[model samples]
Target: MPTEINFDGIVGPSHNFAGLSPGNLAATQNAGTTSWPRHAALEGIAKMRANLALGLTQGILLPHDRPNRRWLASLSTDYASAPPLLRAQAMSASAMWAANAATVSPGTDTADGRCHFTPANLLTMPHRSHEAHETARQLAIAFADPAHFAHHAPIPAPFGDEGAANHMRLARSHGEPGIELFVYGKSGGAFPARQSRVASAAVARAHGLDPARTLFLAQSPDAIAAGAFHNDVVAVANEQVLFVHEHALADRDAAYAEIRQAAPWVEIVEVPADAVSLADAVSSYLFNAQLVTPPDGVMTLIVPVEAAGHPRVAAWLETMLAGNGPIRRVETVDVRQSMANGGGPACLRLRVVADPKTIDPRFLVDAAKLDSIAAVVSEHWPETIVPDQIVGTSPDLALVQTVSSARAALLRVLALEGVLD
Candidate 1:
């Protein structure tokens, strides 16, 4: 006989708010209909944020350093699928004429902490007039054709459209050469993948993953708008997997339960409805701050965050850790403040990429000190220059130096005459 199951229990939701739906909040009864989407989005985002944090603490292998690189890799089919601002900038930049040719342009690498990962994108040819055509030619030559950079995967082609959106994450799966991806059809614009279903197959073949192991998850098969899936995938250890599922606008318990039961070894955790504050739909700070495990307990993240729901999120995470070696959160210098000034620690950093071990988290943090900066500039400035006066004059290194030197000379002349302030 099989051994009797002796399950301890999970700290997650018990009933899982089985009956509550975010859509049920009455607009007329609550605040107003205008705020419904905001509230609903926030509630859902809370759970999603929690999922990201949990996954991170669990060591889901997220790229800590090059966040943009990883984010962009998640897109391939069409840049237009991206948000308006992003799409606009991307299109606008590639409009240069010279960008059509295939030639490597100079680009700053990772050592400087700016943008090192996009080396192949160095060929920047700007265009005028026939902008779109020039961009296409340049991008093709620059990257050896769009298809070459198309995640190098084989996916099903949608009928008539001949394109499918395929998303890929590069990493080793612990067991079974299998992977699962979540893709949602985008509405309006052009989702070539929607008509072709090509991206799915493209993604599978590109990664050389087992066909059986690759599971494609997409919601709203018939919807015109691309939607975020309620499904948040987890990278599992062995034969077991767990996913916390909930529905929006509708009681998706049946659909969720079905998916849950399909994997006997997989446990389905339900989340409580009250987890999010209605004041906002979802909080990004809460999710990013959640401590997911380090895959091998090998990775340590040193994030410099400023006012990102860090306090409340950190407190909640600490309680959940169960004292298991406990996570350590190091708050480095405020990068946001730096970025607002058109620079960041990442921008100032010069990293030694030899061992990855050479990356001392303190290097950037140490460099952020105001006194250290003042000292570095002090040696470079003339003896007559005053650091405080230079700052008051301007932050421009050249301008500040010139003004300081002039002021310092006046001070020296006055001092020689016994005149002082």
Candidate 2:
């Protein structure tokens, strides 16, 4: 039996709207709005509980410390001396999107018969670049059994790495070896291309994946320019099914050919361009849906509430679900707080296929842990955070103290007080 665990990042106290991501449409459109850290954290916890209720193995990834002292020290500046954007980036809670947490190769695919993880360098954006180190540390601790898990550092940069956001796997069964698809973007008009061919190849080699079982596909430049910054924005796969947009890749036919050759049993479901334009797809985040095979063994789509509001997307979804197919149902989740910051259901997690007994107990989720986390968020997290509090001539000292206090409270709840330190 294959145990697939979903590890979701706990929303940090510094969750705010700073419009730091260039190619992310939501972050740009909702630039300076007041963010509710309390609501965001609670909403995320609720999502985890919902997944657990479905009989899925759920885990938690602790948030990275904000006002990162290492980052500031590297720049040779304090908060006051640092640039406004730099300060905001250092305090970013963007790590909440755990999809970019790391690139995972299950034991079934590796030569050593041990799972491999390479933390994403995330060098595309200043806010995300600092996440790799902390992500590696957290993964190492959570997956401490070297006999079962092998943790590797992020790939060297110049070749940007965005982790599993640009990677997907397909197999006949979770226990069997799967074909790993790595999507790289050739050009990004405003935002830099986050994943490179070199980086993808490096990770595959590091994981000891067979070359014949790996496929490298280039992302459509048009999609990247239109704010489909990461490949996850336009494509997702689960088990033997791949759900994607028509314009997701530069060479669709070639990519499909490669996929079919490697995994002939795979099913490809392509959404027509006429039905949902690239713009609509990016805005609605239709492809960012979570494709999960629950206890019933039927695949379900867990999408954001925003998808139901998009006319074309909703119609297409209804039509698709009306028929008998791999995707048996459509479920909507309210992650508005995360959606406003350019993350959705899929972005909130990193999927790992491993035995439950092999994982660290601290990262596992249960009803008691969920209740305790909810309580901590409601009581300690800030109700709202305005842009002025973190950005501008003089930052608010009180806001800083509040954010720090909230993180401490969370650490205490998880019994991980000194983990990050």
Candidate 3:
């Protein structure tokens, strides 16, 4: 009964474009632009609906409390007294990218026979560093069934960990024991390399994964310099397929060799840089696509509309599909809002391989549940959010009230008001 369930983060009402991430090109390019929270949330729900329609299990994680009062207080300043930069950091809805929430090792790969989760201590970014507390709390709630799950607190810092964004898993199937790939970054030109090698090792140990079945590889400096902030941005793995850009790893040959040794069934589908330049790959977020296997046993690539529109990416995908490639079909969804903030479809989801029944039911959803969540989003989420409105010399009390009420309305409808407590 074990399966891969994608737990997506509901786009929060305070979603905005402050360009807080230094290495994320899209977020920087779109900074100061207006954001549509309602539209973003609806697009996300629509994505979940698409996956649900594909016969895959789907679940969701609620948005974290924004203008994180606790984080602000830790910095010795309240929202009203915080500077513009501080205010911007506190109000970030970056948590909407659930992939950064935790690093998961399914029961099949753990020593104790229970799925293991380690909440990431995103210490590299000021805007994201405060997320672990809320992320950990929510992970505890969703995976509270101790019989099948074990949740660990964030990895202690000085060790920056970005969770599943820098991790990948390959198995014969979701229910089988498989190899775990952990990609760490050494240097990234002007951008901070977020995942520390030490942090990844700690997570592997915490999850009790077999050393022989685990691989710790360095992310390509070229890819990171070109704005592939996380490994998922340049490569994504599902089951036996490793769909990646040629320059995604520091040494593709060594990485591939190790991967093949660990998981011989892995299909390395590398897109040559000549065919699709790294710039094109990152901008189009081509590799950020979610490569999922549906019920029909055919593997499908769920990509952002950006990838579908990019000339090189589209052409490459067309050729790949035409051939007898492992990825047989392509499905594009509009996540322009999340993309603008440097997250594509893969970034919006956290993949947990487990039985649907083992997860908290409140987090699971069907078409009807999605419709209800969409209704709440449409009725309450902000139509638009301008950066200046949330991060000026003094907080815009009206905008704050609007975002607060919007989330409250959603919780009430989902009957998850307990999340706030």
Candidate 4:
């Protein structure tokens, strides 16, 4: 039977704060600060372990080789000689947020009856544009079986695409056919709007989704201007439940009406703006929580620790839990490292609905596999990355070797080298 399997990105050894993303408030605020790569990676593994404990299937995507040598070569520069700004962009760990990896259409929702993956071009952000190639390579490997999956190249440029970060689906169960929603930004005020509506339509068409079931919605420009770079930053949906902020969509009433019309059984759980302003929602990532239906049939919200600490979010959550609601339980995980870089728990994963047995086993994990990955991370990842290491004029050979070797060690431990190459 098909089930929701979350494939999270393993934090890379080159994980650092270069402040590359323009609209991501956390990334900009923490720019030039110290970074802990080893800690970051272990935290990601811990999150996977937590989800595994919840009896949810978990999968992982290996980090892309950093200091993106190929990209540098294209620009007629190498990391050692590239300008400081360019070097930082090349070394960015933005790809660690796998939500932008691809737009996924589960077998049940597609005409071909096979899971379809369209890697996002990510053309809007300079640091992230080069990711599609590598992401496609990884997806091709993980879902390589022809009988079960179909892979498509990214939607070509002139149209920016940010993949699943701007996508949501609602249904009664993971195995059932569902309503897919594509949220695109028209204007972001100070920030460039990523995920063009045209791109969203292209993906829906490519996936062969029924027009009646696919809804193209506009993201609130106000929300985007307030640093909600992607719709996922202000909203997330799981089987039949859409946990969203009041201002997440341009027209909440119309969007909700349309949603209800398409999937009449959908339970729209809107967090009031007066209780949690868009700014607080963005900061605490209250709406970005992963809303999932666990085995017991009670829905749970997997949130970041920051949300649990925020006063307004905590109070609102307490009230919500005290009363009877679809979200019956709350679970928090520490991903401060990724959080600092503007990724909450929901940002760190790409949800794919498929039978686990059809996917490449190496890509899936259990406690033992996580143990092996954690051991490699603890033993090989850099302890710390000072700002100078990334933005300094001269290249630090020691840092370079450490980052390269750390990933190499992980690939060797997993016996999955050349997968990224």
**TM-scores for every candidate against the unseen true structure:** 0.32, 0.98, 0.99, 0.99
How do the residues 225-322 of candidate 3 rate in per-residue lDDT, one tens digit apiece? Answer: 99999999999999989999999999999999999988888899999999999999999999998889999999999999999999999999999999
Better of 1 and 4 by lDDT: 4
Give the per-residue lDDT of model 4 (tens digit) for 1-421. 8989999999999999888999999999999999999999999999999999898999999888888999999999999989998889888888889999999999999999999999999999989999999999989989999999999989998999999999999989999999999999999899878989999999999999999999999999999999999999999998988999999999999999999999999988889999999999999988777777777787889999999999999999999999887889999999999999999998899999999989999899999999999999999999899988878877676888888888888888777876654
Query: Model 3, stretches more than 4 Å misplaced?
Result: none
Model 2 per-residue lDDT at 404 = 83
Q: Report each candidate's C-alpha RMSD, comma-separated, in the order given.
A: 18.7, 1.0, 0.8, 0.8
Which residue pairs in candidate 2 collide? none
Please state the error at residue 316 of candidate 3 in Å: 0.3
lDDT of 2 by residue, 380-404 (tens): 8889999988897898768877888
Evaluate residue 256 in candidate 3 and report its C-alpha lDDT on the 0 to 100 scale.
92
Best by lDDT: 3
Q: Between candidates 2 and 4, which one is better according to TM-score?
A: 4
What TM-score does model 3 achieve against the real structure? Answer: 0.99
Question: Ten residues in a row with the worst lDDT in model 4?
Answer: 412-421
Error (Å) of candidate 3 at residue 165 is 0.3
